[model samples]
Target chain A: MTNAPIFERMALIGIGLIGSSLAQAARQRGLVKEIAISTRSEATLRRAEELGLGDSYSVDAAVAVEGADLVILCVPVGANEAIAKWIAPALKKGAILTDAGSTKGSVVAQVAPHVPEGVHFIPGHPIAGTEQSGPDAGFPTLFDQRWCILTPPENTDPDALEKLKAFWQGCGSDVDLMDPKHHDLVLAIVSHLPHVIAYNIVGTADDLEAVTKSEVIKYSASGFRDFTRLAASDPIMWRDVCLNNKDAILEMLARFSEDLSALQRAIRWGDGDKLFEMFTRTRSIRRSIIEAGQETDAPDFGRHSGD
Target chain B: MTNAPIFERMALIGIGLIGSSLAQAARQRGLVKEIAISTRSEATLRRAEELGLGDSYSVDAAVAVEGADLVILCVPVGANEAIAKWIAPALKKGAILTDAGSTKGSVVAQVAPHVPEGVHFIPGHPIAGTEQSGPDAGFPTLFDQRWCILTPPENTDPDALEKLKAFWQGCGSDVDLMDPKHHDLVLAIVSHLPHVIAYNIVGTADDLEAVTKSEVIKYSASGFRDFTRLAASDPIMWRDVCLNNKDAILEMLARFSEDLSALQRAIRWGDGDKLFEMFTRTRSIRRSIIEAGQETDAPDFGRHSGD
Candidate 1:
């Protein structure tokens, strides 16, 4: 671990999976001299303290960010507006205010309103997460080799942006900048849609009249288990993502439903050629993802311990 | 490895993922004294031989099954009829014939007519596979802790069924038995629909106007990558599954689409409670799958190296 801190002090609001993981990663690498952790729930704040995630813990979001040079809003997208209002008064001058929310447009819409005179408001999303949530589910290496996309507004201070990039890099992430709208669209297709689809499929399986739930669980290794992981993500977090990123997710859902309809027609008509083509083409995308090092080459999504 | 073989000789037709994995597992555990591997492709036959997956190799299914006490048809479901016809005459009179096809109902319908008298026709599906296929992809422990479901005809010889069960157990799979139709319905929800949805979503993302394909690959760790693994599964195998198990797949697909539509409506209406309820329920189902010992408890589906 480095002896010197990247920032004098850092504050993390809402110490769940992403927030707790950031704390661990930052602390492990000595990214911050002093860490302040806060959550709306006193129980979670106490739990974060018990985990030794930060040097100080508080239930007041404003109190946590009072002296911190960096403040990360780790709450759900829907809570951004309220948290922003509560903490706006306490944000130190020139502090880099950022968020680790899934949806950037909503974060911008919700929090950009109360931006203090000099604080840098940069919205970011690390392209990393486990289905699990809460502080206990987090670890230091969660962001390793993952992409962290930043959506900074125009006319923002580049120096502050560079510093934020360095901090994410220090935390084991590759940084990329994208427009907030583009970030939402890309994430909608890549993350939000996938989660919604997974939740729906599992729900469908659960509601099956002929196939029992036990059978679904027993036979899940046949592919159903993969979706269940994403479906098992934090309900409140996902609910906020759905509500806050409504338009982008709904748009992707429409495209997905459209493509599904065409595929359904192919299956209904026994168009083996079409089915084969679609199935074969999609295989290459997985290969591309592997080649790009975005995914493990280990077969079966690396779920099985065996090769 | 055990010195005593479970069977005198075993024949494997179609040396792909299932066939090759069976060869390695069976040979490693001494489940069969001699293994004969057959594929329609001479190149694959040579590759299987190169991998040392069997004691002998052949292109002719008939030649492969000759004198073997057990024969497992590992080809796609659509090819069952022709292969059964080709190998029926050469099968040993009391040989136990089975399959590892995903769809049991179609396998029984297609292969039963060609079975010679005194032969046991038990259809089975080992709910174990990786995205990668072919001779080189096989590993000895592919079936470890996985379920191998058997769907036997009402008149299937008990001794032969027991022998097959023992062989799977030797290969490290828990065995379950169900009626062939029930197996089809269960797999329709657990296997077929998941693959179809994966393929559809990848197609949807591929056809996106705003998001580039590279963006999808780069940000895949967000969630889309999970679906891609299933989408990368062997095209021929999945295509045949869709064709052979049409009705059940269609039914499941309908259910899935209906559920997805309702979820979409909830998202549009900003029904956070509805979304939260659905998401929470699905999380417990994932826990059920983990508790049932069908899935790994590692978060992020154990994709990440760190917990």
Candidate 2:
């Protein structure tokens, strides 16, 4: 049986991976009656049209958001303020305005001032993605079984909040509500820290004079390739994440560096027990993640043998 | 169309993941006429027998090595010295002795002193494994398309080294030869440092007082889950690697920490261009790895949609 549409019109401000995926998911699941897609680049908008990702496409953010009941800013967090200002006047009355950026506190700070009256301003982040980006990297099932966290302002109306949560649910995501500040802190440790570490380690490998780049690529399967996937994430998006989540990210980085120094000292002293203890404790966290259905149970992420 | 066996008798001194996989691969490819397995623990030896991983199973290391023309020490690097001392007298005069440990310098230093006259001692590392350990974690194709680096001591018998290389090739691996010291340095950056960084980041996440463990686990799919695969690797094996490859690992860790400091500075100072440049450069390495057949090209390591 088909479900009724949750919103009359859902406008995606940037037709990148997240925007394209949302359009496909909303359309395939009958979550929205019409999907209006927009991006600054004419070629990308034409490609989105060719893919039939939305009912309408435009290069102007205002034109895309006009008469839309749901407007999602899916651009990089760095581009939020400009798009928010450009589309604020065109946002329909009583529309739910949200975002799919990774950092929430910054998005609220950048977009809240420009939001029109009667528009419900909520910030969101989908805890799901692939290494690749761009519109072609999206799929209809990208949000299945993934979490979409919402950080609504304190004065948000309950009906608007409920509707947005229901809309995400219809697109096959579990919804959680969190304070924007707390969201930034938690994401710093879980998401930002990992990406920063991956990028740093890859940069270190790339600059090694003793070890050639060819050697790193040849032997990456041993361990190095695991970090490359995270390092290969969109540069603009990650740059914005690092810039916007500065305080929390810096705090997490400081802690990680401190711990790494202790580990380095342990190795210098040949303390095998300390190393083993640290390695063993982390295994349980991955186990819990797998049991919670947040990660794949397949060994090496099921890269081999497809098991 | 089948080739003749490379060695008349093959002795595997530790029946863990590497040893068990070698047993299966050698047997499946007809690389040896007879296989003998041994481990220090009686339970492990019995388990190896139950799995029929070898033609004969023994608890005594010397008994397994007697009359074997090819002896591979598959234990942790720290255990190489004692095992080498124990099995030195039993190894045949013309036998080729090797290991599958991650650290080559330490393996050479530990296993070389005990090699009897005319015994060809070659330290080898197969750059392949999963996070799982023990016999049940092994499969015949574990080394398929993987590189196996052999660090042969000076003046090693050419015929013996050729035989060892041919055996690994039969098991579906390309073999590279290098000096023991260089192998350790190369692995420190490509394999050991990545694992150490992964372990450190996971430790940092686990000890965070600001973020609950439940929250970290719940939001791990964002980016944290990628590091968990490497963090969940066999603790004992990794511990041995840290202790045995002390100098090289310390050098790589120092480089990694330095790069991380610069990255942190970029983030704190709002240097978005620097962050973007660093993130953009590492993407090409993953692409090169995929092109080299060292990594899976599927997005997210083929975890979703199985592309």
Candidate 3:
């Protein structure tokens, strides 16, 4: 058993779903000796304190970062620069700083300039979350068996990168290292595009005057209910995701739209073969995801939970 | 107690997910006196027999429907025409014939020509399903609290319609009667378009070269897995749904694409207000679905068993 404490004092600059989850996971596994929590609002900070999420809680980022060996900014991507500037003076000289933002390139660009000389600034994204938000909506198992991608600036301390990797591994995630730009591109295709599509489709269903709102709700179990969950995610967080990752999202959207047009044409022409071929190809991916243990094999939302 | 037997003998032609669920529901509730099961393959018929799903099993639809008081065709939409022709000669006099097909307009056109003079041909769709298929992928509660929409042709007998409505009610679903064209339009936006969108997005994620296939699977809990469940549904069934409901699906697809493009433009121009406004409005529809008992209010895929 490795008894190395990843951090003596860890500062979590935002105590929302991701931040609280990280704090819980670290606390449960004894990965940190003490954890300090901070957020913009006193209400959320008080809630985090009430939940016993950290050893100390404060509304000031600088106060939270004092004497911390590792500092993680778990705020929205758009808030990185301000938080980084606010906490820069109090950050320990040799401490490693990272983020759990969805978009990496923008986060790095916003935070790198504010970092002090000796602090290692590495931006990371733990590609895991629930549709819920806030301090109360977190659990230690949230990151279990999930992927945590780290994007370190070139020529930064290799020792700091490995330490961060060890920390994430202790929290029960597989660590992956990639260039910030590549990470942004990949997430834009896999994560951001899907969310944008889901929001748009739900909006489309809501605007339909012919289909009574009651009818849509009644029959949503067929397929539309799945999209509703994603569409119901935090609007501000998603808006930041879209605005920060514009180029890759736009590129993926263009490709998706082109493919959709082909599908529409096939439907219009009654080309059953084309539609069948496309639908058939998509099924194999789901199987692969299941086989990889990324999803439950239970049929229909695992309705047979007791049996 | 009202103990009127809905039908002396009911022939269910196609013992798959929906068909078998109806068999179980009917058997458990004593809705039908006898059920004659028929499918294209002998193996599925044997499985259905082993599961005690019906009283008798047959590979021939004609043999299965002989002397039956009511016939419910539960095959894929693409097979409706062929099954209709096969069972036309054996349907009993004054029997009510209906289908549980997902698409209404196409099934009506395909099955109407083969209906005998004394038979009442009504088309219905039970808007409920799980991602599983085959005989074992069914349960007694599949139809409970679901909407069962029926589309009867003009000049159809009232007694026949009333009997069918009573039969569905006994199986635990409230029945709605509407025109076939209108049913097609309502389902196009609610069901067909959502499934197609899910399949397309899953396909897009699978095709991404930047994101390793494993990464997509590892991080799927971040909204992508929800789409995978819908995409994993029976490919043949969805293909037929797209082909059978062509015009309405095409119109919905067009509207969805237009809305998606406008959202894409908003993101490109950094219009956070537009994105936030749209995302916020879509959340209420999800709330309405929960209020209507179509979905659970449990957050994050209902990870918590009780909310």
Candidate 4:
């Protein structure tokens, strides 16, 4: 199941978590002959060089994309448009241009217009990450057993799309094809809404006048610790997600709020049957997620295994 | 660091996750000389016996409590009253009667009146568990490095409290004491609200018309899977928590909803700065939780370690 080099030269536009992981995965799996990495941050570019993440590293994204047959925009979703406009002229003819943004519709809306006529613009989201960020936070196995959803534009070259899919598979990811708008909607519920709720709940706990923060920290293992992992994610990235996918996120938020109000009502009225029914039904989703191999079956995510 | 048998005979009134874990923990640590187990369900009692979780098993709470020096009510918070009344006469003189329920105030309210003379009734909550339940879910290490908070009445004998604390320490948990009401409030934020929010979000995802359940399941690794762990907790226990700790849970839910509304408005208005600031501040709490040893520092709760 090993892959030959799918692209002679692959350019990475940001050397953050996703970028660094992609570089390592591609190199380890021989997915690309050469990798040229660029980030706007001088320290990050320097760190990428120090880590030997690619064959070439540069602060100027335009220089890195020169002659690169495959270019991936790995910065936050909000940073895609400027990078797209900056590198469009330097893109190789017949090159496949893609992104690893969390929101495909937003990435498409931002970067599609700037893509060169001959470039293949396919937006994608790898549904994998940790709370940590930066080049230092990535490992080659980050995408192992994870789903990477690609939203290739209409009229996209089938060969180019297939090549991109193979590239992701080479990096140890299961590739899924989805429409850009539908991808946004799905991510809005699965990712964006969860992050927003986690942030909101953590904020609520922090603002509590009645309960001390020390108490919250000391007893978090009961449940709050789980949400904190999502809450502790990169702020700038999540803020961008909130801004870029506003419509779908807000719709999911509305539904969540409506559901919370109903749960609140059940508690206030002591409707044990209603509360039990709601809690009972939600358990099946976790089982389904585990059966899908998207989640570990180990208890507490096996966080306590070290004990 | 180790304990001799603290109690000659210990009675467990439920054989679910917490009860079975307690039986194993106490037996493995030599905290009790003999263990007696009971539950309303005859099948569960038979399963408990087959698992060798205790020296004696009974469906009769009274029969299990006879001659036991310590008795723990480990049923759902809502079931405490009837169990208390049934076991009150059988409880040995000077026995320490405690509970492993999540909500302290509710346990105290439900079980205190049924306490017989000379029986020390302390409401305790061990902030440890997985999404799994039943006798087979029990493990000796379940409570290791976790917190067990005991809320003893003001007039209670100090020796009984100390002995109960020692028993939990034998089970490998640190002990903290708080007023029952304060314990309820603290738990409402750290445990109850988180579970409530998780259940609400999972239910909302289930009821979505636009997104298919298969889609949510396939892509849950992004964030939705974290909440699913809490949402998959025992329904009866959570139902009782809502019914019993109504006021504190309601207050926390109100705060969570209010903060969520503000987050929604920020998303609607596209206020990236506000979202960033809120998201940034919450990161510190998670750091504190990790530093305080309340959470695993490993990213994604080390769920991806297997990959």
Candidate 5:
């Protein structure tokens, strides 16, 4: 745990999963002296206040950002523009402004124009979250051992970027800097496309007439249950991700579909060797992920995975 | 744990994940007295014996099944036909013969012709497995709380079917009966399609030119890690499943592709509401699975997940 505060005062624009998690993690590590949480929903604002996730809570984004040296937008990508405009007037000079959106390009474009001259704007995405959302769904350890990618504009202050890196490090994340567009592309394959595929398959299963929805749930332990976890993610967040990362997501989806067509063709043609070879090659990638410390070496992704 | 042995001598035809797990679960639960393990590969049979997975081991299927009251063909679906013909002469008259194959219709069609008049041929599939394979991957608790679907022939004797049900129950499985065709359709959606999708996406990531494989591996915790587990499953087992259950798998794949195209269109058109609706509907299915006890209520499918 950190012993010294990195930021004197921090303001969070949304009190959802990422926001609440950041609050909890930062508070536990003493990364910030004061956390001012603000959200559009009054109910959610009250809930965050009750959870004591921050030193102060308000429904006004501008009010929360006043006097804060650090302002982080933790809302869906679609909501970043409005919040940026709303808080632009109250943003403290020299405050490091950042975001935890899934798509960095869209978030940077949406929020960059409104940042004050002295405020440093850096776009970031912490590649960690569960299927659940909301204030109660967060915990202090959500960011532990996770990768946080930073996408700062070329003219941004180096000192501010380094401080933001250290702040995420204090929250237990390893930060890597990259171009916003490149981050969008890498994340399209690694996160956005995977979520789309999961949501698609779950929808397909729900529409099946030959197999009842009940049977899908009953025998879901087979494999479908794994997809359900990703499918159950917050709809608004995912919807924003899909709409914001459209081009990159579609490019990845096109490539994925082409590969899937080949796979489907091999299955249709009774090409056992092709199927066997492809399946064999994919197995090594999983081993590489496990060896890279991105995945557990636990067999079946661990015993708690419904057998 | 069961104290009484259900069968005097039980023979397993292959020593892979399913075969080894059955041996361990049966022995721990006292469901079988003398376990006889067999495989075409001398190495696997030796490994099974090295793991003390059986009372006896043989590379010859006929030799292993001799005088066994319970014979389970645990080989890949494509090998079931040949193994059935080879072991037909050695199976005991009143023995309960079954299988742990993924595709039941093909298993029945290929192996049913070789079953003798007095021998009871009740094909079954224990819907329990880990991504790992081979004799060393087996554990006694693998079958606990998992489903085991039995696809007995229409003319099967009641007493023998009941006995096989008891044997599986002793090993800690909830048994369900269904037609061979119906089982294939249910499994195509629940197990086979998910595996195919998982394999395809992992292959897509591996073939990308812009994103380095290391980048994908480093940030896999985002979403790609979940698919890797299913994609890492045994190649031969999955290949045989694809070939044997081609029609049902193709049907499910077609449905899945159609649904995915609509999702792609929604993203391309910036239809956030449509995407939101689909994501929301899929979330309820995951909740239903958890309520049905098929998934853990633990956020992110339990904390053991490598996030």
Candidate 6:
């Protein structure tokens, strides 16, 4: 663990899975000297307090940001503008304000206008999560071996950028700096499109009256179970992601639909070779993911020993 | 364990994951008096013999079924007709011949004509399997607490049906009898379609030139890795499933594409409500699956101990 503190105080404006995880990681490695948590709901704020996620908890966003050297907007992407407006006045001079939003461009656009001249605005996304949400859904090692992409504007202060990168490094993440637009595009194909497809398929299976609901549940082992986990993600969070990342999501969806149409035609024409080729090609991508160490090579259910 | 033998000699015609699992389950519980195994490939037969999955092993299907009272065809669906013809002459009088093919109606259509008179043909499918395959993948508890659906012909012998049902029960499966057409339809939606969609998405992602493939691999934790596991399934087996179960698969594919189109439009129009409702509903299906014990409630990699 790094002995040097990354920030004097860190303000987290939503103590959900990402925020609580950041808190846990920060405290475990002494990345920050103190943490303040704020959320719209008092119950969630109380829960964060119960979990010892921060030194202070409040429902008022501005109150939480006061005196904090680092402020992270950990709310859903849709709430970014409102949270930014609320905290803009209380943000400390020369403080670094970042985010853990899924959609980078929208977050940059929404929060950039509210940033005071001295504060550094770096939009970041920590590419890690579970199906579960809330303060209890966090762990100290959640960011270990994960990637955190920082989409800092070209004119951002160099010192602030370096300090923020140090914080993520202390949280056990390898940082990648990229343009916000490119980050959104990359995420659309890898994350947003997959979630939309999963949600749609689960909804389609749910609407099937001919196939008894129980039967779908009973036989989900084949392939549907994989989609179910992604589909079961927080609805509010996903909704905001789709609404915010529209252009890139649509472009990826268009390519996916085009490919799916080709597959459908092959299946209709009984093109065994085409189907076999596609299925065969996909297997190598999975092998690459396993080799990259981003995913476990374990059999189903092997990695969640404690959970 | 059931002490009464269901068949004098039970012949498993292919000693892959399903075949070897069935052999292990039967032997552990003494469901058969003797076991005979065979495969067209000499290597697979040797592997099965080394694993001691049967009392005897043969390269010729006819040789393995010579004295067998029950012959279970465990090869891929594509090989059903060929294996049925090869072993037809050697099958004992009044033998009950069944299969563990994924697509029941196609297997019935292909294999029924080759079955000789006095031999009862009862095609069945056990709704159980892992991503793994071959004799080395077999485990004694593979079938425990799983569903096994039998799609016997309407006029098939009652005694033969009962014997097959008892056999599946002894192998640790709860048996459900359904019409062959309905079984195919149900499986197309539940199993076949999901695998096809997974394979397609993984292929789509792999073909992208804009995003470096390494980026996709590194960030797979954002839901792409889940699909990779399903996409990594055996290509030949899935190809056979796609070809043998053509009509039903095509039907489900059409529905999936249509649903996906609606979802694509929702994302395009920034309809957060529609996305939220679809995402929320899908979560309930996952909850029901977990409650029904069809899947583990543990974290993604936590459920299975072996990788």
For residue B80, give model 5's deviation from the true position in Å.
Answer: 0.4
Q: Which residue ranges in model 3 land beyond 4 Å of their true spot? A: A1-4, A303-307, B1-4, B303-307
Where model 4 places Cα greater than 4 Å from the true spot, the runs are none
Sorted by DockQ (best first), the order is 4, 2, 1, 5, 3, 6
Worst 10 residues of 6 chain A by lDDT: A298-307
| Superposed model 6: Cα runs more than 4 Å off | A301-307, B301-307
What does the lDDT come to for candidate 6? 0.87
- Measure candidate 3: CA RMSD: 2.1
I-RMSD for candidate 2:
0.8
Question: By TM-score, how accurate is candidate 1?
Answer: 0.98
Model 1 chain A — which ten-residue stretch has the worst lDDT? A298-307
**Residue B43 in candidate 5 has what lDDT?**
86
Query: What 10-residue stretch in candidate 5 chain B is worst by lDDT?
Result: B298-307
Q: What are the per-residue Cα lDDT tens digits for candidate 3 across A216-286?
A: 89889888988888898889899989989999999899888888888888888888898888888877777
User: Residues B1-307, candidate 5, lDDT per residue (tens digit)?
Assistant: 6478889999999989889989998988888899999999988888898899999989989999999999999888999999999999998999989999999999989999999989999999998888989999888777788889999898899999988999998888899999999999999999999999999999999999999999999898899999999999999999999999999999999999999999999999999889999999998898899898777888876754445
Q: In candidate 1, which residue ranges exceed 4 Å CA deviation?
A: none
Question: Against the true two-chain complex, what DockQ does each candidate achieve?
Answer: 0.87, 0.90, 0.74, 0.91, 0.87, 0.73
Minimal lDDT window, size 10, model 1 chain B: B298-307
- Measured against the true structure, the TM-scores of the candidates, in listed sequence, are 0.98, 0.99, 0.96, 0.99, 0.98, 0.96
lDDT of 1: 0.91
Q: In model 1, which residue pairs have backbone atoms overlapping below 3 Å?
A: none
Q: Weakest 10 consecutive residues, lDDT, candidate 2 chain B?
A: B298-307
How does model 1 do on interface RMSD, in angstroms?
A: 0.9
* CA error at residue B2 for candidate 5, angstroms: 4.4
First chain TM-score, candidate 2: 0.98
How would you class the docking of model 6?
A: medium
Interface root-mean-square deviation (Å) of every model: 0.9, 0.8, 1.3, 0.7, 0.8, 1.5
Can you write out model 5's per-residue Cα lDDT over A268-307, one digit (the tens) per residue?
Answer: 9999999998998998899999898777787766754445
Q: What is the interface RMSD of candidate 6, in Å?
A: 1.5
